[model samples]
Target: MVRPLLRQLLAMAIVGSTAGCLITDRVEFEDPENLPPLIESMAPPAAKVVRLDRTRSEDVSFACQVLDQNEEDTLDARAFLDFARDEAIRGVTEVVQSESDARRRSVTASFPPDLFARGCHVVEVDVIDGGAAGWDPGGQTRFRSVKEGVAKATATWFVLAYDSEGDPRADISLESCP
Candidate 1:
């Protein structure tokens, strides 16, 4: 039969041209000198429901916009607020420097809305990139054994609780902003 259909169409055209030149030595990527810190943008956004007016004192901010390709290192931004927490409240970072972008950075975190009490919180933003040597300056090891630049960002709001003609209590708390 025409020489077995011309040797099965020349063995399917040589296995479809060598199957895209199968080359594999375990190739991975993303290592432009340990690249890590890059949050881009974050604020009272990412679920957003915030409406806590226990009488309004104001001071519940959190912002982010960190980007680092190792642009001279030094960038430790942090902000956390879990709420139904056994621990996790820390928020008082304020590193600013990006009038245009020297590699970008503008992290702001301020809390004190009574440390949030009405429910559903979770707003973590961490951007660390001091060039990561792991940091163990002999303080007996204060953590961060090695996380290679580290970058984290999360947001989820909902402090609602205001029903005395203040309007903001439609009762929506399945409780899970962890």
Candidate 2:
């Protein structure tokens, strides 16, 4: 099963990287179909599990292939398997996952490090009795929360313009500072 998953992942990576030069600012985790045709045989027709982490929650072997939606930007430059609670901001395990340069268009980023030189971190969620799960492109990402205050992870995007001093600060998001 693991071998098949890895093969599928590899095939996706090759297709993504070689299809063409990226020219926009988009993020994807496989292309053409953008996902495996099926995950579990019983899974719904619409569901494709692109990346999965099953078994132990405390120690995860995280790996995934990602695509740069466009060639003009670096959205794929920073990829992460972020696990957090409802509160967010805090009590989150922001693993500094790696990526190939958006210059490359697509990459297979992993915690163990390959493709890109980006860094990775050891994440330990404080909550062990419970876990959380999140997905983009729907039904792709499945993670068992090691433990965190967040009931689960949700999607939110924010960008920071110039601050009061006109200096850029990523901490100061434009979304009313929320």
Best prediction by lDDT: 1
> What alpha-carbon RMSD in Å does predicted model 2 have with respect to the real structure?
26.1
Clashing residue pairs in candidate 2, if any? Answer: 22-71, 23-70, 23-71, 24-70, 24-71, 26-69, 85-150, 86-150, 127-147
lDDT of 1 by residue, 13-32 (tens): 99888876666799788756
What lDDT would each prediction earn against the true structure?
Answer: 0.58, 0.28
Positional deviation of residue 136's Cα in model 2 after best superposition, in angstroms: 19
TM-scores of the candidates in the order shown = 0.27, 0.19
Residue 38 of model 2, lDDT score: 12
* Cα shift from native, residue 37, model 2 (Å): 20
lDDT of 2 by residue, 1-178 (tens): 9999999999999988899666987876664321211111111111222222222133222222222233332221222333332222222333222354432222222232122122222221221112123222232332332222222212222212221333333233233422
Provide C-alpha RMSD values for all models, in order: 14.8, 26.1
